[model samples]
Target: MFRTHSFVLLALMALLVLTQCTSAPDRSTKDPAEAVDVADQELSLTEEKSAGDWLQEADAAANEVEQHSALIRAANAFQNEHQWQQAAAILSQLAPKKITHHSQKYYRLAKARWAAEQKVWAKVIEELEDVATQFNQREFRVLSLQLLSQAAYQQQDYWQSLVWQVDAQRFAEQRNTDTVWSIARRIKQSELPQQRPNDLALAGWWRLVDYHHQAMTHPDSLTSFLNQWQQSFPNHDAATLVDIWLEPPLKPSESELEAEQAPPEPTLAVLLPLSGRYKQQGQAVRDGVIARTGEMKNLRVVFIDSEASDIESQQKQISELSPVGIIGPLLKDKVAAWSAQPITGIPQVYLNQIDDEAAQNSLTNVFFALSPESEAQQAAQKINQQFPSSKSALVITADGSSGRRMVDAFTSSWENEQAEQPTISYFSEREDMKTTVERSLGLTDSQQRIRAVKIAAGKIIVDEQERSRRDISAIYLPGNLQQTRLLKPFIDVSVSPFAEPIPVYASSATHELRNRLGDSDLNGIIFSDVPWLIESSGKNILLSQWLELRNGWGLSLARLTAMGYDSVSLIQRLEMMNRMPGLVWSGLSGELHIDNSVVQRKLIWATFSKGEITLAKEADNAGSRYR
Candidate 1:
């Protein structure tokens, strides 16, 4: 009887152990306090440091685990300093593991905040959405939804934000919460209309509203888009907003009338290297100046030969003339040498850009160039506008100083304004282009496929797989027509399985789309250039007249003509520009903005279509007298 009792006790004990082992571990549905405790233990610091100092600590950390922990601390430090981008960057590199639920929620919320500060609205939405939906904790979920509403608003999904805001308010009200109710009310009152439509329909309506506003600057593009919008949404309420933007007989502004009435200044001097290697360029300018200002009454223009050999003597002679204003001395070296001295009295316009910082900073004279940088920057801007979501750019340029400068300038503008870094690859010879391009586009992955085939069966066979890297969204080719022609075909083949051609943007150097046969090589390349070069508008008529005056008018010569014409016209209004501080001279070269005696030109954009260069529908930024 005693043995039987012992056996029964042993069985009961075993059954109890099994029951405990098989049962689910209790999960706290509230705050993830264990995770927070872990993070606190890892990240605890005795003394506070500056954001920069914390960043250095994070960088100098001993191992990946320490580095990640230090990065989190650094991000918190940056948040304290309100340097959100720095914080976002520090957090962006960290991939922490073995954290509890509370730590994950805290880290995600912190990341979302920093992302919002960095204007990375998409990231903000993504992080907040994950926290709100995945985590069932009431406090964090409510906070996450509230943050999502604000982030969505910043992302320009106004109606979506409003919906989130409303949802947040309802959730808060059910939980007797007060934090989100006021926010929801404010958003509804200020942002939403009386009639609340679905989010998508509201989004479409707001787009039309934005287009209506954008039409003020880009009427031609707006007109084309509105026509398409009308066709697509004839019965929609947004369609009614189109005709107001499309009405004809747009009135001219006072500035336009003033510019038309503005007479050319009297007794201007012209400096050109009229008898040397630069004579063709000089003569083109002379012809262009003569073509435009030659027929004008009461404008005494004296032509001076600025020979390169005796630049000092020529400049001295120019100074001795003591004319109203000066133009030219087109050589870069001469311009630099001349601008080093103080010419406080006469306002001059140099044809090429001033590279010397002291010269650029000290002189009251204006410097303009047939600037490649301007075209490159415009190309970058156009690419960003066209492909808002695709930020990564790959630049394919010639292996030289010019190409480097173009890439640097383009990258500077793109990274600073658009907030994305661009990859650069250079080619020295046509023979090396294929290899260089293949490496840049990541099409070398095909070699791996070939190797796999060889290892399996000694040759490529049917159903062999290859894939190109999809990270690169656009290509910037700052090379001439031939290089572009050569590089593009290689890129197309490299990215074969992906049918859509990656958008290719080029500078004014690719303006070689004259003949259909020659242009077949440049079918889809977009480039930025002076309107005088691409379009046969009224400006081209003037260029045509200038062209007829000169023989063998190449593209470079034609550009110089436009430069000379605008230079002459700009000096006439130089004082006006200086005084007003917001006036731009609409010249053949571009819309010219002269600030601090430095001339900047914004070129019109164009793209090759069916072997012809066509003016892009979007107008240049049309703020009056602004760059």
Candidate 2:
């Protein structure tokens, strides 16, 4: 058996980073390779193994006439062989299984019953602690704790899941501590109030700083999300990262209640990239921001090119003007640089994503509103929730930044959501994703046939890629609308286990992609998005604001009016929740949730067909899906 501290840490870290080990087999061998490295290996599950093995063997003895081993041994054999009925027969004969087996028997019996009921995960974990007893199988007991975490997670008991995760992490030391810290934070983030940008930001930071170390491509995908997150946590620095990319909200202190009594047109600062490759995007944000100010009485929105401003220079310029609040600095580097500068305390909301310093310091009074990678993760979570029974496959673009981020986020999130904290947070490119998953699930055979593909995806995977595609349920992830639209036709053509053509997606879908992949192409497919189109069933509490913006500003705004209106409405609500004083938002996206930790609903599901989106239901904000 490999007794290297590295392997044990490797398994634990994997659990912490990607949230792994929900349904692995109890191969029971000390060697990780021979036996599935399940959560049952934790010391907490183990104790004085009175007659654990004896009872198990006794259970196994019911069907096999020749084999004679301890009770636990018999039980394990029967369970491994999947002779549930026979195993139960022996367990039924045991007395007070827990105490008799030194607190091992009932636990294993629980496993037997759970397995018999087809609750594979629940059974394996429940049976492990008692069977592994501390004095006899300390490692196994610890593994049980880990497995318990996995079981809680898989069963959607996130709070309990985190408790177990915390317990198992205590034994992890030295090199394993990072994993423990990271996973602990991840569990905390999982408890986010909503999928909003603030929530997504917390989620993103965990996946990156502690795991992948960077955000996704096409950072614009999270624009609406960050805005929403900001609303939840108006003064939080988590919101500031994205706020750095955009402009700060009108400072309420400056625009005091006096404006309402004798309202003057409020001067809103619009920061954007007026002279850069991102000119189009900047213009989009500018137009959206301006279009947003239509209803506000005291508002005179000014557009400033964030690219033109140097860190210190822009600070001086903005302070001189004494604008209501400032926004923009769009790029991460730019935002971080700007954030590092000590300046006036006017509330600033950057359009860019969060910076390392800001996130580390947890700065106050800053609002961040966008984070593309986090948004994709939220989308992936929704996919998992929507189809808990179906596993996903990825058929992403071989190239492109958007493709890379989508493939990474979806693939990693799917596995993490499936496993009990596997270290799949490094699932960056398609190849990296393939290798990580194949190794975890033991898809050695599949790693082979797809040699060239895996190489292209960027990994020297020794596993069999061909066999992998054959083993798991998969999703086809095209990172862009174009990629998604282009890939839709090939679902039936590509090879994977799920007989039916599975859900297809990009992290986003613009009109262009929608126009291309009309109803037929989009049917049964899933995509992530903010609410742009209005449906009769959708409760438009922000309808008046949206109508006011459209009626006053030219209705020629991009599809972001819904988001802007929602953000304002959300902010108002948070302001109302003055007692909390932090961010507070919810019920804004399909399967998306947002809270103080984040701004936008983590995800909003959309389906496309014949150039139109067909989704209407938003996921409830109360579940672990947002967390």
Candidate 3:
């Protein structure tokens, strides 16, 4: 009986051990199928939950772990859908301490992305500055670094931004070498430290930027400079970039060197409507081109009548000539048509600007226009500079397409600079101008108040009216010469004697040298115009030629002549200007520069004083006036 009882006890002990093993098996030795089942269950839980379902789950979660997980999922889902506000709301509910250890990094990244969307750079830096280094995924790591770089750039910490961009390029699938180079360029040479940084990558990048700056003026030394740089930074990440900068040295024979020194003269094709409605304007441009190339033996000029019946025949002729560059299609429609069918190798300079989105992206096509809009933008900048303390402005433009464009440009530029929108008024006729000016200055309201007081007294009273609104600090007038002549007087008279004199600014359309005697009405108004029209100190080499042209073909046509001259001057320098930002070419049309394939002109500022135009005192002080 005792032996049987002992055997029964051993059997019971074995059964107990088998039950325990089945209930909780060792995880390391668990069956692969069972482990996969558990993982599938967790994934199914996540996949089943929608953003709304996740939010609901978060609210109903019984523990901190479940709540945090649910909230993170909800925020991420909303973020993926670009529902930023909803994502922000979801993230705001998450407690930092309650977030799961694995989800903490992702939560911070989501929050930072939301901040970036809101343009809150400080918040982005605050959230990502510490957590960015923890990301193990290449994509997440790269994104974090890029966000940090962009945030730093927005905050004007360019050095830090450069550091972040370089780090990103190291880890990213595709290197952002151009972006790194561009950011490095923004750091001024003067701002660079006297002592090189200890970071080899950063120091190498700085040296590269310095090399590029030196190469802009002295390209011949680039190969030698690049070789020296590579030797200095042999193991640096930018060592590979040296290959891009290095050009093969030309070992030419004496004859080859001579041939290179004096290469074949380039032929330039000029297309203009020489015999149609724009005959006079086209002739002026042709004459201007001839005048500019009269002394040049290295260039050949050819003219094509753009308005001729056989346009395709003209194109064939253009191809046959094999001109190095083509400049023309002055009419907007012609420019658009020419831009549609671009010549693959030859560069084109359009005389008029087009709004076609595709044309703006063409590498070989340049849009150069004597744009009144450009003048309006400069006028806005000039006003802001001259009147830094002025908070508000009034834009008085004529009621036309040109005037509307001027108003739009000025308003856009003014708001960008001041962070405040200016008031705008439009006029159609002479009476409209008077009424618009009076109403804009609050003179009409003042007169009404005076009449109201007289009516209240029920008798005629000689009571002076209150001053015009004092809020307006400046006036922008964008109009033609006739409109300006009619509008300036009304503005001068409408202001109450008690008010401070509001300075008036005008666009180039308002200025004409021949009409200077009539500009007595335009006195005290500062306007932007080309150097050819405003400069008479014999500084502009083309000023004499411009005067001669103006005497023969009116001021209106002479301006086109100046455009033609500038177009020719820019042809050879376009490539250089495109590659080098902030490079200025002193041209007769204006201070010419290129940005994104568009040649922009920075006009000189001049003010009418006693019916004569003189460079604005501010412009003269800044040395922008013709010397």
Best by lDDT: 3
- The total of clashing pairs for model 1 equals 1
Model 1 agreement with the true structure over 332-378: per-residue lDDT tens digits: 87787777763566878887877676566423477888878777777
* TM-scores for every candidate against the unseen true structure: 0.57, 0.48, 0.70
Error of 2 at 192 (Å): 14
Model 3: what TM-score?
Answer: 0.70
Give per-residue lDDT, candidate 3, residue 595: 69
**What is each predicted model's overall lDDT from 0 to 1?**
0.64, 0.45, 0.72
The candidates, ranked best first by lDDT, are 3, 1, 2
Candidate 1: which stretches are off by over 4 Å? 1-265, 308-316, 416-420, 453-462, 513-518, 537-539, 579-581, 617-627
The worst-scoring run of ten residues by lDDT in candidate 3 lies at 32-41
Q: Which stretches of candidate 2 lie over 4 Å from their true place?
A: 1-268, 275-277, 297-303, 320-324, 342-344, 354-360, 363-372, 390-392, 416-472, 493-499, 510-521, 533-601, 610-612, 616-627
| Clash statistics: count for each candidate | 1, 142, 0
Q: What is the lDDT of residue 509 in candidate 2?
A: 45
Off by over 4 Å in 3: 1-81, 90-112, 120-145, 151-164, 171-174, 178-264, 287-297, 307-309, 380-391, 412-420, 453-463, 515-520, 535-541, 579-586, 610-614, 617-627
Model 3 scores what on Cα lDDT?
0.72
